[model samples]
Target: MLKSSLNKGLIEAGCDEAGRGCLAGSVYAAAVILPEDYRNDDLNDSKQLTPHRRYELRKIIERDAVAWAVGVVTHEEIDKINILNASILAMHRALDGLKVRPEAIIVDGNRFKPYNFIPYTTVVKGDGKFMSIAAASILAKTYRDDYMDRLAEEYPQYDWISNKGYPTKKHRQAIAEHGITPYHRKTFRLL
Candidate 1:
């Protein structure tokens, strides 16, 4: 049972990013402000849920949340600033898109750069512990996966539709065989 919010009195947004560890494609982040009463038994960390479940929850979150938006940092940006900074930048971009301002932000990971004078708390694995964070995780992961699936059509050699840009054995093998595509993060260990 994920907690609805970290602070009861304030409007809080949960933040999380996906594809930070991937070898290719952009990192995606989501900031979600769920209603205080929102609850769903199936909602959890995106990683723990199947693709079907994540997609299902994405629909639910989008429909039910007070405000939800996604942000994306491209592979070129990741190569320029490095993954950690890119991930944070993505989160900031997500927060920038929020229609409603949040009094507080609770992030999934331990490190997050502050946004817009808003107070933020970084909780290790907050996505699994907080409902809003879990909703954000689902949004980020599903959106990134959808992006990678489209990229896979253009660059079938990487098999991104299946691996979703993660450095799987087959993905590495494809990099070795066909060389890196424009989508591959050059700073990453592609081989």
Candidate 2:
């Protein structure tokens, strides 16, 4: 079971990003501040859940959370700022939309550029350990996946609906066959 919060007293927001490792598309991030009493048996790391389950949980989290927001850093921005900075920037943007400001932020990775004067704690694999983080992960992944799926309609060559911009075998083959699209990150080498 994922813990509800890291610190009981602080109004904490859990932060996570998706598509950071993808070869194309933007990196998406979400900051979720769930109620302390929130609980769901299916709640876990977004990666562990199926697409259907993630979507179900995403709706629940959006409806039940105290505050939540998703943000994206475009492929062009990711190329210019680098994935790490772009990911953190996306997280900052998500936090910016929160109706309830967090007292402290708990990010799901080992590195984060601080948001404003608010202090933050970075925990590796935090999504599996904290409910709010897990919720954030689901929101980020589903939203980004949905975006890629829509893009797939416009650029069927990339097959983003299947690979979701990841450097999968078919995606790399598509890159070799058709060349990169404007959405593809030119700096990223697809191996």
Off by over 4 Å in 2: none
Clashing pairs in 1: none
Looking at model 1, report the run of 10 residues with the lowest lDDT sum: 34-43
Per-residue lDDT for 1-191 in model 2, tens only? 88988888889999999999999999999999998767887889999999999999999999999999999999999999899999999999999989999999999989998788998999999999999999999999999999999899999987899889998899999988988888998788965
Candidate 2: worst-modelled 10 consecutive residues by lDDT: 34-43
Error of 2 at 100 (Å): 0.9
Query: Local error of candidate 2 at 134, Å?
Result: 0.2
Best by TM-score: 1
Clashes within 3 Å, all models in order? 0, 0
